[model samples]
Target: MKREPSLRERKKLATRAALSRAAWSLMVERGLDAATPEAIAAEVNVSPRTFRNYFASREEAILYSLAQTGPGLLDALRARPVEEPPWDSLTQVLPAFAAAFADQRHIIGSLLRVVDEDPSMRAQHLVTYERIDRQLAELIAERIGAEVRRDLTPRLLAAAAAAVLQTSIEMWARGDRDLALPDLVREGLVEVRAGLPAGAAVRVSSPSPAG
Candidate 1:
């Protein structure tokens, strides 16, 4: 029989989830500037201290909520059968990522709006993207059996991929009409493949940028 999640793990997960929910709700209701950690704690029925225990700051908490979309996408990609190529896995998983945004379009729209309105949020958004790019690079490195380094080749490819993914996400988020996010992701991948040096082997196991 499969063992259940440990009590500690479950509690940690619950606390983080509650904190994320509380932060997002406060952000939507009062805008990011007005949603202080104290206010978020009060909204979540937790003390400010407890809130800090779960998150470093109000901005960090909000960033966590935004970054939560990444892991879900990774999980979907991991779930693809081994027989599938990396590209196929990505194509299959990307729609699921886009579908998530479509599901929470309003919250996403609100977050994007708030970020645009606040310089601090804009900086935080850039940091979040850097963090995501690093994670994607790790995934790519693992797939290609290469180390992530300052070298031009790895860095350039990673940067280009990240740019594509980021642009795609922004387009989908800002569009008046709903976009098929997965399709955009696939198109981006195709572009990446086309632009690579001739005779370069495409590794499907690696993660590509969302822009």
Candidate 2:
């Protein structure tokens, strides 16, 4: 049996979600520059202080809405059954992720547009990417039983994979080009794999280096 979220936890999640929704809605209606934290707090029926408790700034409130998707990706990776290859697990989960993106197409498209137009938001976007890349590297290290380093092979692959996903999502958000997002994601992964040096494989060892 699984435990559900406690009331406090649920309320906290709801408050954050409300803030995110309110921020995006306001940004879409008005421009991103016009969606002040005070305005968003009023829109969500929360005090400005409560809004600050949930988010550090208006930009964080908006970016949090999109960065919240990262946990879903981690959950998808966790849901894969034992004995599945890392690549195969990733491939299987890509469709579900794409579906989620499709569901939020309008909000995501608007967010991307805001990022393009605002320098602060663009910096925030880069920070989000760096966070995701670090998470991906950790996941890859766990899967491959390899030491992860800034310049190590597995870490580089993880960074490349994360980049591919980011690029694909950017392309998808650019316009409705009749191409499926999952197809684009798969193509991105294919390109990532193709770019890796030939015969790259994880090597397992029994002993740790002496301290």
Candidate 3:
């Protein structure tokens, strides 16, 4: 029932993927400043103009692989049995999603570190996640039989799921914990489903007035 990509489309996808990998490697090795459009295009045996045809900027090219997370998560969620509850469906997909990047954990950590250091890269990173969140909201709406625009539940659930994913990955990327990324994702999702019990808060004391 589904149509396959044409030869041209397949070639374009391949070229784009190659560009993404080249950009990621260059950025990791040289940082953003050195990984310019020309450098990235050179790594992929292409012209700077060709890179423009595929991606708008160096940051976009480098973050392209990371952006695939949205499509991967959505596809996995769609594969879940429709009869399952929305929460259960969401909870089940996260571990698989986390596991997909298990071997690339170092790459993810490196990319995130680079993104955090630069304002433009951070902006691109946020933009990538915001797009993912929008797609997720739509999918959640379908699962729960809610209108995307009229109902808040789908949007809220999408935001919560996205937060859990991002937080868990960031913690795992730090390599401070003994558990695997998928385990952290599973635990985080479970905690959210449990209504996120209150924890001790860090309070800041008021400053004394100057004499």
Best by lDDT: 3
Candidate 2 local lDDT, 140-202, one digit each (tens): 677767777653855776677677678778888776455777788887777666764443565
- lDDT value for model 2: 0.78
lDDT of each: 0.71, 0.78, 0.88
Using lDDT, rank the candidates from best to worst: 3, 2, 1
CA error at residue 185 for candidate 3, angstroms: 0.6
RMSD of each: 9.0, 9.2, 3.5
Question: Runs in model 1 with CA error above 4 Å?
Answer: 1-5, 79-89, 150-157, 176-178, 196-211
What's the lDDT for residue 140 in model 2? 67
**Model 2 misplacement above 4 A:** 1-3, 149-151, 196-211
RMSD score of candidate 3 (Å): 3.5
Model 1 lDDT, full chain set: 0.71
Model 3, residue 60: distance off in Å is 0.8
Candidate 3 per-residue C-alpha lDDT over 106-158 given as tens digits, one digit per residue, 9 for 90 to 100: 87788778877899899999988889999999999998899989999999989
**What would the TM-score be for candidate 3 when compared with the true structure?**
0.91
Q: Where's the lowest-lDDT run of ten residues in candidate 2?
A: 195-204
